[model samples]
Each structure stands twice: as structure tokens, then as C-alpha cells.
Target: MNSMPYIDQKGRVYKYGEFFPPELSPFAYNETIAQEYFPLTKEQAQEQGYSWKDPEPRNYEIQIKNNQIPDHIKDVGD
Candidate 1:
């Protein structure tokens, strides 16, 4: 109704620090620790109304080499 809580495109209202319902959560069951402990197959998880996600490939660029960095705090200068 206000900035304290606002309605989403789906008509759901949310506020910071408030607990969100599992069904309304942004994370898929497979993306959370629940999958690590429970460990369900993709078919099983989706059948139970939980979402699953495929792993994404990540590529990071190395900006600096380890040897190029200063080893001590005092070694760094503007």
C-alpha cells in the first residue's frame, strides 16, 4: 500500500525483512540448501510444485596476477 510494502506485477505485496512464503520465494528449490540436504531428482522436485534450475556457466576475467599484487598493507600506495 505504501513504500513500507508495495504490490508486485503479480499483485503480491512485499516488504523488506519480512518473511516471504515459500511459493512466492525467488529461489528455486534446486538453488537452495534444501536440495543439498534432501537431494531430490528434477522430476520429483517439479512434481511437488517446486522449481528447478540448470547450472549456469560462469567465466571471470582476471584483472591482476597474484605476484603483481602487494603482499603487505604498507606496500600499497596511491
Candidate 2:
């Protein structure tokens, strides 16, 4: 980590800029920016051995749900 070449999948991600592959990210693949651009279903993400999380529907009167929003801005309405 210091000056030595890190062996793949050997170092702990203790700091920012240190990262694992998309499949290894602690956050669900569906929750990552990759999902925002290259969308994938729960099945698709899991089939690739990537993490997937089914978020619990919140109980707020009104919530800004970033998850499961429309891919196209045109589809969004007030």
C-alpha cells in the first residue's frame, strides 16, 4: 500500500481512492453510479455475483427517492 505494488484483492480499502472492483463494492451494484448509467436488474446484478440490495420502502409523507427513479428526465413530472 505504501510503495510496494499491491497484490490484487489483497489490500483493505481503509481510505478513499482505494477501491475494489464494481462487483466487490460494499454498496449494492444497483446503488452505484454504474447502475444510473448502465442499468441492471436485481437478477442481472446478482447473476454476475455482484451485491444487490432491495431497499425498504420508506414511510415518509413525501420523500425524494433517488432509488428507482425514471432513467429519462422527460418521464419525471411535478
Against the true structure, whose TM-score is highest?
1
| Per-residue C-alpha lDDT of model 2 across residues 20-55, encoded as one tens digit per residue | 455556788877799999898888877666788888
Candidate 2 accuracy as TM-score = 0.46
- Whose lDDT is greatest here? 1
RMSD of each: 8.5, 11.7
Instruction: Give candidate 1's TM-score.
Output: 0.56
Using Cα atoms with residue i matched to residue i, what is each candidate's TM-score against the true structure? 0.56, 0.46
C-alpha lDDT of all candidate models, in order = 0.78, 0.70
lDDT of 2 at 22: 52
Clashing residue pairs in candidate 2, if any?
A: none
Model 1 lDDT vs. the true structure? 0.78
Per-residue lDDT, model 2, residue 8, is 32
